[model samples]
Target: MAETVAARLLARLREWGVEQVFGYPGDGINGIVAAFEEADDEPRFIQSRHEEMAAFEAVGYAKFSGRPGVCVATSGPGAIHLLNGLYDAKLDHVPVVAIVGQTARAAMGGHYQQEVDLQALFKDVASEYLAEVNVPEQLPNAVDRAFRTALARRAPTALIIPADVQELDYSAPEHVFRQVPSGPPDAPSSVVVPAEDQLARAAAVVNAGSRVAILIGQGARGAADEVMQVAETTGAGVAKALLGKDVLSDDLPYVTGSIGLLGTRASYELMRDCDTLLIVGSSFPYTQFLPDFGQARAVQIDLDGRMAGMRYPTEVNLVGDAGATLRALIPLLRPVTDRSWRGRVEESVADWWSTVERQAMVDASPVNPMRIVHELSLRIPDDAIVTADSGSSTNWYARLLRMRGGMRGSLSGTLATMGAGVPYAIGAKFACPDRPVVALVGDGAMQMNGLAELMTVTRYQDRWTDRRLVVCVFHNNDLNQVTWELRALGGAPKFEESQTLPDIDYAAAARGFGVDGVNVSSPDELGDAWDHALTADGPVLLDVRCDPEVPPIPPHATFEQVKETTEALLKGDPNAWRILVQGVKAKAQEFVPGRR
Candidate 1:
């Protein structure tokens, strides 16, 4: 018999290029952790107080490194916790591999301690799942599949090995592992280019149109320069979704900016005013914000076939990679050097930015959410990484914050999960301690996962600088923003307007946990608090009270929008009916209007 099963797995993991990971140890996983300890070339292991953090740290590592990040945990709660982070990875298109230790095979159904069905718990959340019932022979294949599926779809996958398997010794040659395949080219070579006439038709749409807007999603990052060239030649501008913000700089003359709530005013105005909107490489949601017949004609060019016609109707839905499709289409355009159309749209964008100076400005209000974000944005080192909690803070950051060339913003912007910001902030600081990291949270979300990290941060602060983690809480009392939106969506209002939260000092709660605490009741105190945290010797907490009535992520609904959208949809009023039809026409004339 060989010495131990966990030792062999550890050896193989080192061979698979794993360097650092996070997890918590337990009784069943003793052999596994011991095996980890016994290994000569041991990977660096960071301890997580909760299994959830263990999984999320892997998510952060994968996002920052663009590689598969690994996490480990014991059975029961450990294996069950792979859901949230795994789901986060899948939806965000990140690759993560979770190695969960299961209870002994014999003890599985006998009400054994820490025994649970990890396979069933993770089935829906994972892209691929493998259970190692036997050791040695099957282990390599299972590990390979976990990595392959995780990377293959750019999502999270799992490998669950029983504790008994980790203890059983099976001798085998160590050279059995094979390389993870680089994967096939996304689109097949058989996907032939459009015929010359089809290319000419798209080109005519490009050349004949005076004002064309190119909308890039996450699918457009690689072909950014080429898209810029097309816009340069064809009197067109660019509009990107929030995920596509990195495709071009916010300052680019041809690039009008992003088009969603996190977008710039100029980009939305451009998309709303163009003759034609050319969507490239994005499956962005929020169809309501897109240009319709009255605004602009939309011609989408996307790689994923499923995304076509999912949102706005397409005038000419071109199916191909953004770069490849643009390469094919540029040749067909009858080179027209007219600058009037492109120049005018850029002018409109400039005009929009001029009027939007109300954003991110410091005000004399006792507590201003925008001012707090603005001050942090200004004082925090330009390299600082920020994560926005899904609350008023999220809304505020989406409007007021800017990401420089090298800066990264972490949030589950797609799925919009509430508690991710705090955990992601902790994980980011753990990975990149040098960059100033601030986790901005609304009180509702901070309390969800905030306590889990107090121990970890306190213990690590002695060794690592306490300044790395600055937890800022917006103590607005109630779930004011969400309840407000619920009311906007036809739900009941949250009591009267003159309401607030119960009295309990959150800064005091943080102080009790051995973290730095600063209570900010006035805007005068915000800059000093943030500055203190930035310069402090450990992790700090800043609890600032932002009035609940401050405007949300997007400005509060205009009277026109409220009457046009709400009354028409909710009220039985005849006047509301006309606005509803008009709203539909405003959003859907591109696809098919006046017909549901």
Candidate 2:
């Protein structure tokens, strides 16, 4: 009896403890697909409607499990379709391994059907690690390298296997197949201890500063205790990047919410006033939100040495694990007893949150989007996993939803792509079946890919015991974010017809797909709808009629932005009047003593 390359590779995946691989099947991958069907191991193949969704599911799985996500696709078009989702993983630095099928090796360069230079196609996205298994003997090594590279680098990797190679008989001895030991795979972990000199220099920078503030990212998620200890010793306020939403409790008095365009007033003030910035495990790209090197002395700590001081210049670049570096530097710093600066900043945070609460409670005609999201934030279980789309929904989720009580979250981080929310919820549910999963998406994004992806939720709805997948669709019938951006920022007068969408009955569609469905057109109906979705026996799609008139105002507005809004309002744009009113109210609050 002889084992095929596909069999051996599948065996290796089992040895590496891969329980499943998300993918779609096609003719080009018939050999590998056949092998997958024959395998009696844990790495079962889960079929998806589209190759893109498969890749997004893989990225979502990695986010939930904190392990390398695996996905497979057929040749040419199948592989090409994966770029968007692969880019999602790449830009966000999530570990994903994409296995793509190729045309037979012998038929290369002869205009063969479904043939492509996969390595070249994936070079930019998977440039960190991309390879093809040209022969049977190379299969094991390619598998090992791809998985290892993805985990170590925290990026997507590609393995292109030609159809002929997948079918080739394994001529190596039986011992060769057993080279990879059968045990749990090595989990992703890092503990980069900086040199003593680097630690001392970083400590000296922190010790010298009177007003310190900390900026955290997803990299510091596991070091929450260390982050707080450093904050306590130095009397610093913490501003989180969107990815670091749960790095610390939202209720913490000194922990400011997210920074950047989606930031709070407290975070903006913290960045504006700090004399020294302590950056930990964050490669936050929006430099304008951070104080310039001239404005503040900085100390940066990152596990990857290359990322140290990449976003902002620093007095000391400590290349080490965030936890380890913070622990080492905490002892050398003196505790700040004068709590005056922190007290003022805390008051600002309180005032800002009160304003947010007022905005969320605003009684409007077409239901305010914030009201739905705020209600969701209050109604969702503590252990819920929320995945938000990239649009108006993201604006509400980022600003309103507070991550606490062991709730987890995932979104298209760096790429900031749409169509990831529903698939992400499905994948998150797959990875952690015991927890509740929710997808927050706008009408535009839901119509883009999420509606079709709901069938995927229907397909796997009964596979797990705890089926708490909820798709909360904001049916506003417009690409509200783009409309506002074009009007307010691009100097356009009104939203073009191209940016608007037809009203969709998403709840009806979900019911058509054999899933539970609810429709709410007003705020009064919201609570019961949420209750129905949360208590449903299977996946539920809640379609809430949302107001497209609400503007996604930033924490701080510039003069130019105000000018544009006034121009749009004078031009009699549909939503500009409400926006102008909101802007005026915000400006008035700014002038009010102790209100900002």
Candidate 3:
């Protein structure tokens, strides 16, 4: 009796610490599935309804557990479906390993049912791309390399196992396990920025300026102290992007809150009042909040090349890793004895915050989205992990939601695609079962992919992790925000009739999958429903009807966008106002729980 090549490979994957491999089974990868079944190895295989769910589940697992998440897909479309999750992982810098089964060696270059250039299709999305050659011995190395690249680069990797090679016989190597470093990658550039003079000059501006501000982004993830040091040095107020929220403590003295479309007025006003703005790791796309002209200069630093000057022109653009760059800039910054800079920004933030309390969060409507948003934040426990779907949810939660220590979130800032929240939430929960997990999604965005994840969560609950997470759905019927955006851009708003979705009963949809589902329409029912679901032992969902027209538009969107949407909506020109249908009437959803 001889062992097949697939058995040997699956054994190696098990040794690599993959606990549960997510994917749909097929003839192309039958040998590997059988190997996974037979091998006395680490990961057990789970069949998903769709290949996208497989990759997405793995993504959730990788993000929460801080390990390499694994997924297996057959050739052609199965492999292609992995692309979106792979892209999400690559862009967001999560480690994921995808095993894609390829066509047989005999069928090389021939059109096959489940055969395509798997490597080529995946190459763009993976940090490392590999295909097993005819030689069976070469597979372990490719797999090993892919595993290494995914974790080391903090991105996704794809391995294509040719169908014929799966059955080839080979000797298994000794010690199949390898552990990659879990820390953030080394700072991109070694040559430090010699900003002694610039730092001093900037420090002087900070010292004298009436107001100073800090904009933090993804690069600041691990540099909380360093970022705080910069803010304290100049008494600059801090505002973090959706991804950078975890880095700075919410109670930090100089922190002014968040800014964006869903931004807090306090943070927005603090930024507007700042005489000098120091951007740390953030190249946020919204330029409306940036200072039009401050006697104070702007200093921006990042590891990525694209972020430099992507928005407003930078007074100083220092290209280096964020952690290292900030350390270098620290010594150059002069300490300011006077607290004027801090005082001014703080006052502005306070005044603006008062306005929000009076307006957005004050005595409000029966359909107030802010009321739902604020109330949910209060109920979510500190250790829960959350992922947000696109549209107003992304904006509202990014700016308004408050996360304490131990709570983290997943961001799709780069692609900003809809439906990612559902998959990302599911993926994160799979990775950290002990912690509660939540997926906050608008009704439209949830429909994009939430239905696919229902079975996966139901299967895993009480069986694998036993932790029941929450999927909070916002049922906002109109495409209100998108319609408005279209109107802003010289487009008509007839998209109202064409793109608006009928209100869906999300709780009913979840109930169909054997998960707990609660529908709440009013304030009182909403709180009671959330309380009941929070105590349940399995995955539960709370579907609430959030107001569709509540998302605050960015203060600075062009007049053209405003005009077009108005004409389109008023004139009944759906075609002319088509762009406005993109994200209108989005619901804001949130979850408060640790993941699997």
Best by TM-score: 2
How would you encode candidate 3's per-residue C-alpha lDDT over 1-596 as one tens digit per residue? 79888887776776676678889888888888878767753477766778887887787678667788899998888898888777877777778889888889889788867778765787688746555545666667777777877766668888888888888886544444542223222222343453566555645555555567789886777677888888887777898876676667555556766767656655766667777777877867777777775444677777665677677666767666677777877876767777976876666555543444333443223445655656767677778788887776666566556777778876576667677776676677667767777787877777777776787778767644637678888777755456455555556543656558787788898999988889887766767776776677888888887655553555334466566556656776534332234223221111112110
* Best model per lDDT: 2
Cα TM-score per model: 0.80, 0.95, 0.84
lDDT of 2: 0.84
Q: Indicate the worst ten consecutive residues by lDDT in candidate 1.
A: 179-188
Off by over 4 Å in 3: 1-3, 127-132, 171-211, 292-296, 304-312, 315-321, 351-366, 463-466, 555-565, 572-596
Residue ranges of candidate 2 with Cα displaced over 4 Å: 173-190, 582-596
Stronger candidate by TM-score (1 vs 2) = 2
Candidate 3 positional error at 82, Å: 1.4
Candidate 3 vs. true structure, TM-score? 0.84
Please count the clashing residue pairs in each candidate, in the order shown. Answer: 4, 0, 39
TM-score of 1: 0.80
**In candidate 1, residue 250 scores what lDDT?**
48
